[model samples]
Target: MVREKNPNVLSVHSIIHRQALTAKTLPTKLTTQVFNLLAYLLDICYSLNLLNLNLQDGGSNTIYHRDAITTYTYKFQLWNRKIIACNYSCFPKLFGMLEEALIKQTDTTNKISNQLQHLTDEIKRYFPSLCYNDSYRLAMDPFTLTQMFYRKHCKTIAVIKTKYRSKFNIASGLRSALSSTQPRIENLCKNVQAHPSH
Candidate 1:
């Protein structure tokens, strides 16, 4: 009816909604397994949403985003280990659902362990840059580089300090160059008068 009223209107279905519809076709014997899987997935989704929100903060730059991604990658590893060990402390909703349903820890762990490991692997694969500990450390904390330089050679530290000081001086110089100020028109006129006319 809405399409009839507006011929140009677009209709779209969510991928998640489609997945839910597909899940309903599973056998009745697997109902508990299905619910357990859904609960575990929902917990993961919540955790991912928190990371998304953290990245969405307007003031954060690439360094912070990389830090967040690195942290989330580590979390995936931790979650994989916990799930393999049948420890549900990180997944409160999944734990509660399993408790309420009287489901065995072994069942949930067996079901989720491979999938969680695959997810952890995928995360590490997707973010190859996270392997460079030195770059992340330098970007997140300049002092780390300074300390390393100081340890390596005192001259290197002095050079780095000079470079940083020059950067600040350039920024301040640009600011003063752009600042609005009244020109000395009278002094200019007097100087023009004092000069011999050609």
Candidate 2:
């Protein structure tokens, strides 16, 4: 009905549903292992007198540590701020270091390995895998995200400058472009309608 009223309207599903699903289906056993790790870290924090560590702040106990750029609590609040304070491009390397630390602490224990495996599985389920021949690129890298932001910012600035310089030119250009493509679009539409399978 909405599409009938606005035939040109485009519909795209929100990405939040994926996030919600990822959060909802988090494995409890993995969470427990993470809690154990956090507890161990908390004990170390106490011993090292790192009173500024706020891991115990009031919120979900579930620690969602995938990478520095993607760490959060189960309530979806950003967690591990200190861990993300490194250079922006180093964000991808932070999780590897953390995993190494975890491994060093646990001496070939199946519990830690199982937890890490579950975490890996959950990450693969939620995020785009870093595999070749994969096409689903995500804007998760800080450096890449910054570059994209600046690129769009520059484009927006250019559009604004052009609009201020000559308002009619933009509309007239679009009109001409649309007029030039109208016949091709109509022909494509006709072909699709006639074939139904095309």
Candidate 3:
């Protein structure tokens, strides 16, 4: 297999402009660690819909309840902070944290079951051959049985029907009528009265 490397590719700019001019005093490792934590936390929240969860449950948006965002958001911050303080040690720690969050989210009673029975059946059928991570892959597929159950509502929607009306062919119907064979005179029952001359 050939790997394509662009000749015009330039130097890596990951650390280029995000840091300040005082960066010589900045802890470069800490900055990278914080960035990693932010990335990971964003990934987990995205995949699990944490924002939606917080808004729906965790009490009405009172001052205390609204701060639940801070609580949940802090978990990600904690994950990042730990890594930074340890100087980029303990990725397993981060994975464990996200995994626990995922597990907890699954335990929440937010699932609509009747909508997902078909998906559950499919999963059961595939259980014999499935491997470890395949369950997550199958469960999260947009087209899977489970996803059909959950729907987002919208106020005004336009649906376009893509099929066009067929143009009628008046000439073909007339041609078929014109080409039909007439019954032979002798074979026509009405005309078959023994020809008196015959």
Candidate 4:
């Protein structure tokens, strides 16, 4: 009874055990709260397929649904922040989780963007503006997120930028290319492994 009641009877790995306990006690509110909204926004945008020239009044319609974004943001504000810091020094850990959430959300957005052309058979617009808000959130860092990404990839990302990048000739380029060739590739590529085929 004394051994069971005593607080001092701890093993050598007490810190690790305590952290795991705390993490499980509190929840990781990253995906359901934040990243899922980003994914749904990307999906709606792909489905809408807004064209620049389609708007005659210099006004544009959004592919993204705003109410969902607002609702999720409200929920995050209401509950996403860590409820149990557990210790005086655990604030950094709480911040680290937030930073993880923001960074991972941006990564998920990029993956969805990369797959946009295939989704709902829509045109893929590699617009910088598409992911601007997410980029802004992730660019400001709490530092350990780089380590997290490295762990995810199991290697460092090698970004070797070229001095002279090829400018996209969009006017008679991607639309024409897609219209002319993309269908053939989709149709004839059965029993084949490569995509964007032919």
lDDT of each: 0.77, 0.44, 0.42, 0.39
Candidate 2: count the clashes.
Answer: 0
Please give the distance, in angstroms, between residue 12's alpha carbon in candidate 1 and its true position after superposition.
35
* Models sorted by TM-score, best on top: 1, 2, 3, 4
Candidate 3 lDDT by residue in tens digits, 1-198: 122466665665566554644576768555544544554445554634855666677456443343444444445455445533432222444455445444222211112122123333543464433323544445446375344332321111111111112434434433433445664655667755555774
- TM-scores across all candidates? 0.59, 0.24, 0.21, 0.17
* TM-score (C-alpha) between model 3 and the true structure: 0.21
Candidate 2 lDDT over residue span 17-126, tens digit each: 87777777888556545755565445334523432233444542322222321332221221222223321112233344445445332322344344444544565567
lDDT of 1 by residue, 22-85 (tens): 8889875478777788988999899989999999999998788878888888887788788877
In terms of lDDT, the best-performing candidate is 1
RMSD, every candidate, angstroms:
16.8, 27.9, 26.0, 24.9
Candidate 1: lDDT over CA atoms?
Answer: 0.77
Tens digits of per-residue lDDT for model 4, 29-110: 5433344545445434542443222433344334332323333334323322222221111124333444545533444334
* Highest-scoring model, TM-score: 1
Model 1 TM-score, all chains together:
0.59
**Model 4's TM-score against the true structure:** 0.17
Tell me the lDDT of candidate 4: 0.39
Clashes of 3: 0
Better of 1 and 3 by lDDT: 1
